[model samples]
Target: MSSHVYVAFDLGAESGRAVAGIYDGQKLELKTLHRFPNTPLRLPDALTWNVLRQYAEILQGIALAV
Candidate 1:
């Protein structure tokens, strides 16, 4: 049988990461491809996430993974 491979992008409140996984018949092995910060910006009035920047980070992570 052929091997199973998987790629995952895990986004969290503090950061994001790209992971690659290999699956055997009974177990799975995972490896990290890239990780970037996602800390929100805190201002006097509010806290916000820079979505545009985060998107750019995602693109970067994808590029690095490839």
Candidate 2:
């Protein structure tokens, strides 16, 4: 049997996480690969979501997947 892998990212109000789904010939499984805090970045002009940091964390999760 062979296995397939999939990754998903979830960004929420308080936090963000990366999840992995593994499917074999007959079964599927889910696991949380990484998690990070989602906070607003306070810039001089306006507040924004820390997207760059989130992106980095997502990459980290992908690295761990394989």
Candidate 3:
């Protein structure tokens, strides 16, 4: 028998998460690998996503998944 792996990213307005799924022919199992806040930065005049931080979180999530 062989197994398969899958990853999913759920990015919402205020938060984000990474999940992993493993399947073996009939059933699937899921696990939450990482979660981080998708907070916006309050700049001098406007709000914006902290993109660098979000990128780092994504990397961390990938690491966890691996």
Q: Tell me how far candidate 3 lies from the true structure as C-alpha RMSD in angstroms.
A: 1.2
Candidate 2 lDDT tens digits, 21-60: 9999788899999998989899999989998988898899
**Model 3 Cα shift for residue 40 (angstroms):** 0.9
lDDT of 3 by residue, 1-66 (tens): 798888888888899999999899999999899999999989999999998988899889888877
- Cα error of candidate 3 at position 49, Å: 1.2
Error of 1 at 19 (Å): 0.9
**Candidate 3 residue runs with Cα over 4 Å from true position:** none
Over 4 Å off, model 2: none
Please tell me which model should have the higher lDDT, number 1 or number 2: 2
Deviation in angstroms for 21 in model 1? 2.5
Candidate 3 residue 25 C-alpha distance from true site, Å = 2.0
Per-model TM-score, in order, reads: 0.65, 0.90, 0.85
